[model samples]
Target: MVNAPAEQKKLPSWWSGGSVVYQIYPASFKDDDGDGYGDLRGIINKLGHIKSLGVDAIWICPHYKSPRVDEGYDISDTDIHEPFGTREDCQELIDAVHAHGMKIMFDLVVNHCSDQHAWFKESRSSKTNPKRDWFYWKPPRMIDGVRHPPNNWRSCFGGSVWEWDEHTQEYYLHYFCSEQPDLNWENPETRQAIYNDAIRYWLDRGVDGFRIDTVNMYSKYLDFPDAKVVAPETPWQPAGDFFSNGPRLQEFLREMRKEAFSKYDCFTIGELPNTPSLEKILSYISTDAEALDCTILFDLADLDHRGGQYPLMGRNWALSQFKALTAFAQQLAEPEHKAHALTYLENHDQARSVTRYASDAPEHRLTSSKLLATYLLTLSGSVIIYEGQEIGMINAPKDWDIDTEYLDVNTINTWREIKHDAKVQNDPSLLERGRAGIQLTARDHARTPMQWDGSKNAGFSSNPDAKPWYRVMESYAEGLNVGAQEDDPNSTLNFYRQLVSLRKAHKDLFILGRFQLLDPGNDQTMLFTKTALDGSQVAFVALNFSAEKQPFELPIELTARQSQLLISTLGKSSESRELDAYEARVYLA
Candidate 1:
């Protein structure tokens, strides 16, 4: 087998071609100035750590001006940074990320804005307001002389989508929280204002691109038809389908691409809902010139176990399911559309992948982490590494709870309604189950303060007396912090560092190569290899998902005399070796 290049190669031009993307949850990364929340400066401080991980870029969760209704997803102004810092701080953070040889992608939440935003407040003030059409507003239906909501649409936050405005005797639609009103993209002025400010804000700040949030929800059906209702037992709402992939979504995205995104050599990844069609994905992320760089697909998110009755699965980590899903995604991403699909296992809204997919066995956490990394990075597409995945962090313990005062609106309302409905139905178990599901689904679990150390509060907040925006996972106390991991070569941290170094060392083979999935039908394992155009093949990725070692063979015919085990979680490897339980290996081929 060929030896991996010894020297560090120049940053791959194909990094923009499609490479690793790290998702950073702003509130948990680090606290600057003892604010008890991560700020731009905190990210700035960790640039070296991020660079060390071998990610080509980062996607920062919103730091935009917001009332924190949905943890900054509720935008007040796309142009302004929130109390997190000034525009200058954002610029500095962008510069720092670039300085570390990593690009930065800002999160763009365009579907809705906080009620406190001046535009929303003005639109709600009067029916005669000039900007009344800027948002979805309709006269309240006078049913039996009592004002009623305009339509049957339900808010994803579990209430009427329309909120009554006493001053104007009108109701406005909000897809998420009532305080975060949906914008009327049907109105050109509204679209233009959002586009103009948002595009300039980051481009001027030197951000490499944007991860467009809730992109499919930006355009709504003008008719606002009632969606097919989900059964009461399931929390799923039909109303989402009515607006999730609206007719004008592509039109809006096209305009977004043409006006703001297309002008520069920027990368754009759409956080699209549903599994968008291949044609759609290609149109959105194709290298052909007028589209986003890639789009994060929900293939993995939709692979949850179904209780048989629901449209989607409940929660079961099946290797077969993961294999099938990833194979389908890879087929779409293959050598031709390599830059189109953004490969990711989990994000802020989903349960942590290591905990969910890897089974979280202490003995197997590292193995599972390596398996997942091998499966994701070797695929032919852009890759997004969710925060904390590199260190093998598992989901937080279920015992943790978000007290009412500390909960964000979306989650707090969900907790309240689930409990309220359970009490009405005299079903205590429903409430308990709901709590369990919340624990599994809460973004706060992942957004919790990063495990910096074993110190009180995990060394996230400067003042020991201060409280962080979210609880820190107990793994910190158990010695899973950066300070501890950095010193241990056998730690998960070093494994990731080595993984990055290998990719950097073999830039041609790893970064700009053609990827081929070795065996797509194997459920108990994953195998793939990347080959550069010049005939140099640097690595082979293999993962064992079965609890017991399962025999498997490579699909490709290898001429190399031997394969060197470059990195592995099993701690030992050879040219021809069996993978231990949940073991993952990257071999020089």
Candidate 2:
């Protein structure tokens, strides 16, 4: 165990309060040396911008040494931050964030590793190898003189999960991509090695915590039963329920907690998809539980469909959908031993929220942005804001393509499969274009180089000719740069500044308060209030579904002489008691 320095005295209250955590997608954040990708030095340069947002922590996406199969998620080394910069650069980032009074949370992708990783390479070389059992390798069945996969499980990118290894004469299951071989957590040695090495590597580097990728899938059923085939031939996988949250999960977590996380006041949030049952989440992050500190449930993100419910396609989002998502969050927050849920509108894997909600109009886009901010910040859990969310960045324009070359292996493979499918043959050009139009919609949209100025390359890189690995939105060249936004008070950047400041100042009501639903029966709109223990009642909310102004009355009988409008997306709340289209308001009642 790494010993803590004697000078350290206390830990920050990141868990029990509303702490603003900024997520940085390193590759597209900014390029310092013009390497065509973002680096640690670039992040250090942007510390002032992060601080200006009044956030308390920053979640740096994977920088670990890897083959970059799945961005940096397919990590080969747990101890170092690779091509992005040196180990010292990572330490420098942690130190810089600390200097700004903010914490740093690194991405930890322990569920799998790139096929090129030393461990996977060794495990696949021979059946008798010492590391042979390190990964989920199975003997191929002899069928009609040909080898067949042990089961019919599909991968996340779509298609069979098993990959035939000619060298080992066996098949290995990869839940994500063929390149990302899933680790066998059934092995004690493998689990211990990852825990000891990864936790020590970052803890020693002084990182505040980690955001775990697919934490629930670490443990699998010993039987390895084939999941119910949702799509047998086409390659679409289900939630992996039979293989997730296995018997050994808690055991493995307690070991990790005992060996590493418990030593320091660290925070860990798991990425558990389709984990709808509250019991499953509670066991993982309850204060007295055996595992992590929190988790990012897929409920809200999955609820985003296009059929006026939640649309994953690059179609416009409905205000009703936004309201429904927040209502779900409000319910999750009420669990007595609720595992802190990370509420978000967009992330590196999803499409941009602005484009998902607002059509091609900037006015509606900005209004929807505020509406989301109001709903997100009002929740009682940790809030993770994606890189470009602050300025209301939208999805990539339909004309923009070229995402496959920049996407990770699994993402590219999935796009190719979708393109090849006859079902979507109507838009054959989309496949030739790499589904750069939709499959990679959200991330690529958010990954556009941080708009720094109307400079040559949005001021993200020094060379205008250098390919940025991802296309930059054309707006940067038109005056959407950071410099321009800094001067314009009306810019999306300033509005975010005000939004964050309001969240920080009202911590008691927002962070430590109880969330109560105001219009519980209304599916068309979401309205809620936060009542602090100290009797400071703050009515927090948003109106997203319909274009018409929605009328709402207070749930409680309040005799206050006047309601003070703290913040409103629509003009003054006092003047307009009725909500305008996509309007959000905060009031002191």
Which regions of candidate 1 deviate over 4 angstroms?
1-15, 78-82, 141-148, 232-236, 305-313, 335-339, 402-408, 507-523, 529-539, 559-564, 575-577
lDDT of 1: 0.71
lDDT of 1 by residue, 190-281 (tens): 88888778765566557777888777788777887655555555434446557677777777877787777655556777776664477666
Residue 326 in candidate 2, Cα distance off native in Å: 3.1
TM-score of 1: 0.89
In order, candidate lDDTs are 0.71, 0.70
Per-residue lDDT tens digits for candidate 2, residues 1-589, read 2337333423554555656789999988988878778888999989999899888899988887777767777787764555478877877888889989998888888888888889999999898989988899988868799777776665666566789999878899788778889998878899888877777667776888888888888887767665665554443445356647878788777777777676676888788775667677778777668578777876556544322111223344454555555656555455465556568878887777765554336547667777777767767767888887887767666665444334545455555565565355576654444443353353556667787777777878766677787778876655456777786676667777887787767766776667766665675567777876567565556454456677766445233525567877764546555777777777766
Assess the local accuracy of residue 330 in candidate 1 as a C-alpha lDDT between 0 and 100: 63
